[model samples]
Target: MTSPDQPNPEAVSDETLFGADVADYARYRPGLPDAAIHLLAATQHGVPDPVLLDLGTGTGQVPRALLPVLRRLVHIDLVDVHQHMLEAARAALEPVRGSCTVSAFTGEAHTFTPAMPGLAPTLITSCRSFHWMSRPRVLAMADRVAAPHAVVAIMGDGSLWTHEADWTATLRRLIQTYLGDDRRAGTRGTYAGPGRPYEDDLADSAFSDVSEHCFPVARAWTPEDVLGYLRTTSFARPALFADRYREFEAEALGLLKAHARGGVLKEDAEFTVLLARRPGGAA
Candidate 1:
């Protein structure tokens, strides 16, 4: 969902963005921190028949992370534009399914409504995928789909590129050397970044009451892990490098190896979650 947005954008289209990187994304992308997971599940603490609708359900990461902790979560509806990613999500969640049922939709998050009537979500979540969607529209949709006490949780930590570290700086330079001065966005040219703070977006929507949570997350990455992660990023995906992608990868690996201590690279990040609710809403 880090890809650049074109005019009249929906969720980042699979064919242009992560069509070939879905496997790498599922394998290498870190799960939400345990503290974050507990907090999400805690929001549904008193609700009856809690349902979770993950708006930009990339490979079902948010739901997968929440399901194990949320025994009360009876149903999960995942929405993403990419069928391939949805297929991957469906397959991954199959082994974990117990009493709960999972359904996936391939379309804009703003347009999704549960097929079963009177089935509003107890919690609505948009993780890393929120920035790619039309923010205001999605929030308005959430207002309609969410129960009176439900909260719309927007969660993400900045990617590796945003991390301020020696290793990340070197990696960025390497990517710039092969690509260009700007971040390479899939199909849509350079990334312009999400201009407005997501907090502002929430304030402007129906969900005006917002609470923020910050979690300290420390991650260790091997050179191999870093390589796998780069494959999932729009800034360094193979498609952006043309025929020289192999050359770029070789150089990138060498640089990463040089930086690794005990064959490990460290990333410390602040993961933020904004839990938004309507005025006087409880959750």
Candidate 2:
């Protein structure tokens, strides 16, 4: 639904830009976060030797997975606007000892550049983080730093409900149990809260012009995993709420118990990969 001309409002905040739920995020969503390594495996050559750059690289996940494959993963510059996230990435990457050149910096996606000084990257990868970028600016930036024959791969949750079919019902029961007094507001609304909404591409813009593909990845969780996943979510943070999260967690757990089959919640979800190349850049 987003257009090239409209700036996605969600691009502005630093939700977990700080180191808030980084550990939880790394735990539950480890699969998707680590999926960037495989992205390079899908290159035209079927195995890539391209110079890489990772935008919004959280906890150094991409670099950790990719360093082994590339001939020389030179000048890996990870840019994140959050200082805390960068700190976590630094810590995670510090133990790495190899020929790869790794560096972390604090900057927005648009301001990020390869560390190789005037070099354009042959491959660029972003995972589950582009929904927060300004569409027009990002596409223009991609067109700039991406080498003539470069490839960019972007992954996102095309449909969060792709897995959790009955989240609404679960949510309803949870609200009824936790907020016993006023069930309506707690269930239908305020789960994700106002500005922090969970959906995809409010505007269908130039970036959507790329060749797109989707595949189902792992999306199974017990009540505990679900709780861990929520802790990593932008919505589940204490700063975003007026009330203590215990009430919210109790309500959420109630919903899961009410709708869960055999006390477990399963959802059909997949990862969407959008691979684009500059028209004349590569064959």
Candidate 3:
């Protein structure tokens, strides 16, 4: 998953900050929990084949997870600012093309223009990537492009850096020692927490009928898997450390190995989904 933090106050481009890590991201990031998909599907029960527009669809994790459950979906549009990430998402969704029309767009979440006319999405989703967006702008864009009564879902779980497991805490300490206490993102900036909760943003937008759901997920990680996951995160992308990348890896692995229990570290995360829809009925 890409870091939700804006690269810097200077406004670095998402492609420059995250494109290089697309491969690792596609390989190692966790897919959305089944409950999230179920909730989304439930919201569309009576609708016919619907169009799904996923913004910041890094490697298509959200679409891929929903594919099996959203069998009736007629079209899926994946949008991202990074071409590499878009390419990866297209590749991941290729197998499902026989079931639905799948297309990709390279642009910001708030500014994407669908290629076809009358392509208003019936469901819009931004997983993990919502934090990187101009929330109000994106919501305004959603209001413009979404079908009436369309559900806009924003989902995320805390990253490994924030996990509370002993091994994870130790690992985080090691990262802080090398990268410093503030969470480093991209090349030169630290992550800034959102000033307000996403619920507030949705409550104030056109999609004001808002609800939230959380799913409990237990994850077991081997030292190697943990390291691979690190490669995909904003806080530990190799480019952020440059020449010291290998050295940092070696030290981090050693620390992880020391803390692992039976070659695995366990963490429990609450995957939260916030669902919003316009007050009026579907158009």
Candidate 4:
């Protein structure tokens, strides 16, 4: 392990950050809580024909969750830096696409523009992903392509690393034992989160009119589920462990089992959604 004075490892290029974890991610990462999903649909109410631009759309969770309830949604554009993620997103959303057009773009969210120009979206979303982007640049792009009444919804509940429970605390300690004390991030670096809250970022951006919502969610996990979720995390993914990932997995499973109560581990999470709109009386 590097000394405290040592610099953090250089991060992998953003495009490749989550590429290797797609399968486990698709299989195990929790979807947006249903309350949040319904609220997102309501955000588009009264719009003539709503369309969606889901930035950093990991496996298209935002769209997949909204499609069933947001029936009038006419189109969806899924953008991500990783093509692997976009591919999996496409597969997951196809059966539910209905008459709406679903398109995937493999590129940075800040640089994405519609293949069909002049088609502004009524709803824009980024879930658990805005931090991985050039935040100001993305909001600027969203400004150029959004309908005046469109809402930019940034949503996330903190991951397992932030969850506070006796079991999760134990799990974090075990992870630190294998990795390091500083949070491991992506493939090559430690996580240094945004300096200020996302609220501060929005306050300075085009979408200065903002509101926040929180949905309390309760989730239960099995030891196997915990292992599968760990495989998709930047901190504990198999690559981070090198040759010892199998050992880590075995040990992690045992540790989790010992902590489980009646075959379950619990998470009490609050999912937060920040809805931003242009600073005007459009709505």
Per-residue lDDT over 179-209 for candidate 2, one digit per residue giving the tens place of the 0 to 100 score: 3423222112333222432222312322333
Which is the leading candidate under TM-score?
Answer: 1
Candidate 2 or 4, higher TM-score? Answer: 4
- The residue-level lDDT of candidate 3 at 19 comes to 77
lDDT value, residue 228 of candidate 3: 90
Off by over 4 Å in 4: 1-16
Better of 3 and 4 by TM-score: 4
Instruction: Give the clashing residue pairs of candidate 1, or none.
Output: none
Ordered from best to worst TM-score, the candidate numbers read 1, 4, 3, 2
- The number of clashing residue pairs in model 4 is 0
Candidate 4 lDDT, tens digit per residue, 1-283? 1011111133223544567868889888998988899988998888878989999898889999999999888888888877778788888887887887777666778887786455589899999988888899999999899888889999999889989889989989999998889899965599888778999889998899999999998899999998998877777878888899899889989999999999999899999999998888355
Regarding TM-score, does 1 or 2 come out ahead? 1
Compose the digit string of candidate 3's lDDT tens values, residues 148-230. 76899999998998888788888888888888999987654989777799989998999888888999998888889888999
Separate clash counts for every candidate: 0, 13, 0, 0
Q: What is the TM-score of each predicted model, taking all chains together?
A: 0.94, 0.73, 0.92, 0.93
Give the least accurate 10-residue stretch of model 3, judged by summed lDDT.
1-10
lDDT of candidates 1 onward, in order:
0.84, 0.57, 0.82, 0.84
Ranking by lDDT: 1, 4, 3, 2
